[model samples]
Target: MLKDFRAFIARGNVLDLAVGVIIGGAFATITKSLTDDIIMPVVGALFGGFDFSSYFIRLGAIPADYKGSVDSYAQLKAAGVPLLGYGEFLTVVINFVILAFIVFLLMRSVNKVIATVEREKAAGTAEPAAEPAEVVLLREIRDELKGRGAVPPTA
Candidate 1:
């Protein structure tokens, strides 16, 4: 059982999956940062500095002891207030869309390259190989023999 488990873990698919998961986690962090730090800020600036991060609906009443502003989503949440964080959700959704689109474009490019290589391979195999010099010489000799009526021209 242990040997079988070891073999399973040693498989190429398992290793590749592990590496992909690690890379995907790292990629997620970068995408999140890009969305949060760069894209959202630019988008906000374009929309007259409309901040989406603060957009939320209060689901519960603020405690009397809460000193922070009730309008602030972070402050309310930090004060144990229930809130519907639509803005944060929207930001995450946007990040996901961007990441997915980038991955799709990358895959499309890779697939195109693969398809081009496959077509070249297929074309190479479909075309006849150039005849060797000896084969050409033999064919010429046969043609001369046929012209002199020494041998019937074989098709």
Candidate 2:
């Protein structure tokens, strides 16, 4: 069982996927910070200091003086205040869309590179595939035998 487990853990796909997930998680953090810390602030500044994360609807009987920041969400919830967290949701949605677009643009670039390489290959501009010796010999033999009137009986 332990050997089987080890083998499973050592599989190439599993290791690669694990590494990819870790990298993806790290990438997500950076992107999130880019959106929340940098991008949102600029966008907010453009709208005259309108913070996107502060917009929310109060659901409970809590007072309207609740400051709605990231810290405020926890406070409001801790005070047993029922609230609609639409602002946070909107921010998350925007983040997802931005990330997807960036990934799409990256994939588009990679695809273009792949297509260029393929085109080069098709145009014989790339390294040629070497013909097998047996195939070459057979083609030569066939061409030579084609001229012979004496029918070599097909085996």
Candidate 3:
């Protein structure tokens, strides 16, 4: 069983998938950083220096003057406040949309590359150039005449 498991793990697809997962995880971290640390700040600044992340509707009296920049969703929930958490949700939605678009674009390019490779492979073995049917018939006739001791006509 251990040997079988090792063999399974050593398969080409399994190895590729593992590598892809690791690369994807790293890429996700980069994208998350870009979304949170870079893009969102610019987006927030554009809307009259307003950060949507801290904008929430409170249902209970955690504090009437709660600072907009309180850290973490757990804290908000723990504060016993009936909360909308709209800003955080909006941020996450934007991040998802951006990531989705990036993935879509990447997949589009990958598909194009796969298609091109398939097309090239198909082209490689599809067919060699063929003589015209009339030319083939004329060659057969010429060969038959030669076999019959006919003199060849000079072109």
Candidate 4:
């Protein structure tokens, strides 16, 4: 069972999947940073400094002991106030859209490369496959036999 597990882990697909997952996690972090640090701030500035992440609906009463600002979503949530954080949701949605667009562009480029290679192969512009050694040897023997007149040559 341990050997089987080792073999499964050693498979090319598993290794590729592991690499993809690690890269995907790193890419997601970059996408989130782009959305939060750059895009959201610019968008807020354009819309009269309307911060999306701070917009939330209070569902429950703030605790009496809470000392944080009432308008701050993070503070209200930390104060045990029930709230619907739709602005944060919107920010997450934007991050997802950006990541999806990047992945789409990457796939499109890969597909274009694949199509070009296929076209070259179809047009015989790609390098030809090498013949097997046995076939080459047989063809050499046939040529020698034809040259020596031991085998009939084609007209």
All candidates' TM-scores? 0.80, 0.65, 0.66, 0.76
What lDDT is reached at residue 33 by model 2? 92
Show pairs that collide, candidate 4: none
lDDT for every model?
0.92, 0.83, 0.83, 0.92
Instruction: Score residue 56 of candidate 1 by CA lDDT.
Output: 98
TM value for model 1: 0.80
lDDT of 4 by residue, 1-155 (tens): 99999999999999999999999999999988888899889999999999898989999998889888999999898878999999989988888898999999999999999999999788897567899999999999999999999999877
Pairing residues by index, what is the TM-score of model 3? 0.66
Q: 1-155, model 2: which lDDT tens digit per residue?
A: 99999999999999999999998899899889989999889988998987776777778676667555444765787677887888888889989987898789988999999999999788987567899999999977886786684546466
lDDT of 3 by residue, 1-155 (tens): 99999999999999999999999999888888999999988998898887877777766556665654355455777656678888879988998888888899999999999999999999999878998999999989998898888956657
Worst 10 residues of 1 by lDDT: 146-155
What TM-score does structure 2 among the candidates reach? 0.65
TM-score of 4: 0.76
- Number of clashes found in candidate 3: 0
User: Is 1 or 3 the stronger prediction by lDDT?
Assistant: 1
Note the residue pairs that clash in candidate 2: none
